[model samples]
Target: MLSIFLTIPLTMHSQSLFEYQWKNRLIVIFTETSNSREFQKQMQILNQNQNQAGLNDRKIKVIHVIPDKHQIVFPEKSGWQNSNLYQKKESKIDFEVILIGLDGGVKLRETNPVEIEKLFDLIDSMPMRKAEMRRNDN
Candidate 1:
């Protein structure tokens, strides 16, 4: 939820992923298409109303990566962003999910559809998340 509306200049779009580093944790979903089964399931899991509070609390921003189009769909934004992070050749799989931490590192990788709570649990177990919880408890 941190700086969710902040806009970055186009010149730095290549480093847009790092633009979120330290400010928010990321759940990047790389899928073949926005309408794929895995993509739909993932979106369904994310759109649940009950998960809103937790999602905001954890500062999670979801990015949908359409490898075929070589673009990333950032939340609260309108069109696709061309990202070099995704290359169809680089990933042979059709559906892949990656959890990135505040330090700009990949924390988890899942090939199939995963539940939201599972992701939340994984994030909650992170050392940085522990520290963040401690800080918020004050």
Candidate 2:
């Protein structure tokens, strides 16, 4: 159930993340640019097909939010989207990572590049995800 709902003009300046609420868990990387070192490393860590698979298994989408450039990048989308939607809401930090759950709750927040294993472990521990896995296993 890869939700590839590729709508254009990703610059919606509203408080609601309603579009991603029920369907996808989200990893939001807040950085100054696509080239930011921490951002690069974080993106690189998840660049593998297996890592991507892990994310898909958990119904997760990685989004790069570059407030300085007024852009947010969606994994399912082709290019960077011009938007200030995620700017300043989390903070003015140069780099930060946020893990959002399917229910639109902030599951984890970190000032450094996230460890994928840690992220996966947290998700796997969640009751919702445990049920999801049980259904899949059955």
Residue pairs of candidate 1 with colliding backbone atoms: none
Quote the positional error of residue 21 for candidate 1 in Å.
1.0
Candidate 1 is scored at a TM of: 0.80
Residue runs of model 2 more than 4 Å from their true location after superposition: 1-16, 68-75
Which stretches of model 1 miss by more than 4 angstroms?
1-15, 68-75, 88-90
Instruction: Note the Cα lDDT for every prediction shown.
Output: 0.70, 0.70
| lDDT for residue 38 in candidate 2, whole number 0-100 | 96
- Tens-place lDDT per residue, model 2, 42-94, is 88777767788898899887777776343334457546655565555445678
